[model samples]
Target: MILLLSLSFKNTPQKIREYFAFGDEEKKRLLLALCNEEPIDEAAILVTCNRTEIYISTHIENTNTLISLILKNCEDIIGMDIEHVRDYILCYTKRGAVSHLYKVSAGLDSMLIGEDQILGQVKDTIEFARECNTAHLYLNTLFRDAVTQAKKIKTETLISKSGVSTATLALRVAKDELSGFEGKKLLIIGASGKIGNIVLKNALSYDFSHIYVTKRSHNIDMSPNVRDRISIIEYNDRYQYIKDADVIISATSGPHFTLTKEHIKDNWDTESKKIFVDLAVPCDIDERIGSLDGASYYNMDDMKKYAVENNEKKKLSIEKANEMVKEGVEKFLKWELFQENWKVFSDATKSLEKEIARIGEKKTLEHLFYKIRDNGSLEALQSLIDTLSN
Candidate 1:
């Protein structure tokens, strides 16, 4: 039996979901932990700013027991109470689990419908699971099918035509707040990470006079076109550059705040308008900064209005995408059914082959044709033969 436990922005607030967000290493650890359990046969985890999904195949059919075990393990990893978040978890079994995954891969389940990032995230999650040896035949096939459908949806539909994401949305809001990025200085914290890198790449398209990125120890590899355009600042020096930045975006996997009110209180210039965006799941910026004069702070929850507006505009595309997802679900379910019955078909074929060897193929075919001609239709017999031959 396949089961899915999802804690996403759709049902859970960021305050709760943040506790479940795991970095790549932590995710791999959790995967190993789940796979270590006796009941869990195969498992894969998808962790994003918007959701944390655990897909598992188990021999145990009891949903409550499975959910409890999952929550307990998560608690052990992250130190959160299982009962505290039990109501927020969405559980799906068998077909529902498959359908949910397909929709999630297709971006239908995203906070910002038709966003382009979730597909890649799903792909990366499956790859990670495979690398950890936590994913086997069932999970691998499900993920592969989901990714294939997602690609087809993106190619055939205009759902992701704009290629919008949290990074782009943050930049858009910043541009709007500052009356455009021209003559502005931009700062990106945690620039070597995923969301930070996206913010860096998206910022390049704008007309900001200067762009600065913070790096801890890892070297940033920039494209030739933008290498000269960006300047690297040590992560420790981030506070010094904050006053000059018209737009500051902080996205990291760290547990603590990247920018706190105490650090910026004395440095911030109250006369100049500035935008502070935190795209991390646990949130990289302090909430109190929003109250600071001339400062507008935004976080993942703040992106909802923009996502809702985008979703409304793309209603038709979303409807079409959902239809495509439904079709994909049906096709995958049929394939799954075929896989389940394959052993039976193989055994029958082997038995038939043995019988043919005993009677001779010519004699067996003659007997079959005679029986078909007498009671069954010859056309049906020919179709069966053609199918078996294939």
Candidate 2:
């Protein structure tokens, strides 16, 4: 049986989702450990900012133990009780698990539907399992098929192209709000993240005079075109730069708020038209900061609102994507049937080989042994020669 348990952006709050999120090293360690223990024969973990899921293959009878093992592991991060964790977890078994992986790989299950990044993320999860020696034949084929189907969806449909991602919506709001985009000083609180990079790439076309990018080390790698308009600044100095910017995009993964109400001082000039785009899930900027005079704040919900506004155009493409998933699922089912058939075929082949060996042994051994009494140079009869006796 195949099983998947996930804490995702849908039907779960950010607070609960964080508990399930594992970094690369943590995921690898957990996968290795799970395979080492009982019940789980194979394991693959997918950990993204918006979701955390573990996919495994095991006997149906061991399902309860498998579920408990995962929940116990999650306790190390959130320190929450098993009953409480159960409320947030969504599980899928066998066919559902297989279908869920298909949706996730195609980005249909993403916070930003049809976002291109989740495909790479799915690839990473498979690769991580392989590196940990936890992925066996079932998972390897499952992931490979998922990737192939996702690519087909991307090429054959317009789902990704028709939708607006959170990163793109952030820029759209700024463009719509600002009078002139040229020479506007933009502050990106967490510029090294996936969404931040997308926002920056979109902002580049607007010709912002100076773009201030803040990361922990104030170090960033950029393409030649992206390098032209940005300056890397220390994260500590963000508050100082916050007051001097027209647009501040905050998308950090910090456990707490990176930009709080204190960051915007009471005496500070709030007359300047400043916009805050909080792409972080738990929210990098404090919600209360929106109360500051002339300041506008947009959280993930806000960004998603704008993204959904463009959903109508993607309706047709989304149907096409779903059709592709359905077709892919059929192929997967066929592959599963093939696996089952191979097992029976293999057993029969083994039995036939054994019978052939037994029949050959019964026919000619005793006479050969008696006749080869004092063999001098047995090279002449090499083709017929056999070690008849010890």
Candidate 3:
């Protein structure tokens, strides 16, 4: 059986974090241990801020053993009673697992519909499992196919156009608030990350004259085209640049607030009203920062509102994408079933051919003896036997 077990933030975000809070080395060690356990053929784990899922490929007879091993590993890592969280775990088998992965890759099961980062997260998790030698043939094929299908959907459908993503909505809000970003200084906190990088790309397409990016590290190198127009600053020096900027977009996965009320209180200049977009899930900017005298803030939930309102127009496209996903999953299942049956059919055919050869040999010997004993023509007897067999 192919099993997928997930504990998502939808029900227990805090608890999920506790299990994945360890460093990479520790996580790898734990994964190796889990893979070593009995009845676990293949094990791949995906741990993010919103979800923690384990995908396992094993025999149906070992289902109980696999589940118990997972529970034991979770208990060992979390050091707490996990029975309460078990109820929220979503489990899938075989075709259900395939369907769930397709839905997840297509963003249908995301917390925010049409979010684009989940696909990369899925790929990264799969790659990590491969690196650890914990992935089996089944999972490797399934994940590769899931990635291909996701790219196909993205290219063929309009589900990812316009307000298809929270990052795009954040950019739209920035443009709307700043009135086209012409000749403005945009301070982008956490610009080295995924959403931040996307926002920077969108901002560059606009009329912004100066783009300032800040992160925990100071190792960023500017491109030749925008070298003169762009500046890289350390995280600590963000306040120095943000005070003079006309717009600010913060998207960081840091545990705590990267932009606190105190930071905004001291650096915010009333002469220019700064538009801040927080695309981080936990949010980089504090909510109270919006209540400041001249500061405007938008969190992921707030950004999603704009996407939700505009998505109504693309209802048909979304429905079409859904249908495409359904058709794709059905085809995959049919092909998988055919593959399983083809082996059985081939084996049965070989067995039947061997039995027919044995019977034909016995009958040919009997016919030869009869022809020799009857002193008749061998050709006539062989022809008679051939006709009877036919």
lDDT by residue (111-139, candidate 3, tens digit) is 55656778887898789889999886777
Off by over 4 Å in 2: 61-64, 176-183, 207-209, 215-228, 254-256, 348-390
Each prediction's Cα lDDT score?
0.88, 0.78, 0.73
Top candidate, metric TM-score: 1
* RMSD score of candidate 3 (Å): 9.6
The reply for model 1, stretches above 4 Å from the true place, is 217-229, 350-390
lDDT by residue for model 2 (210-319), tens: 89888764336667866767888888888888777888898876768888887577435666888888887667888888888888887765554566656666778888
Candidate 2, run of 10 with poorest lDDT: 381-390
Task: For model 1, state the Cα shift of residue 285 in Å.
Answer: 0.7
| Per-candidate RMSD, Å | 4.0, 11.6, 9.6
Question: Candidate 1: minimum summed lDDT over ten consecutive residues — where?
Answer: 216-225
Which pairs clash inside model 1?
none
Model 1 whole-model lDDT (C-alpha atoms): 0.88
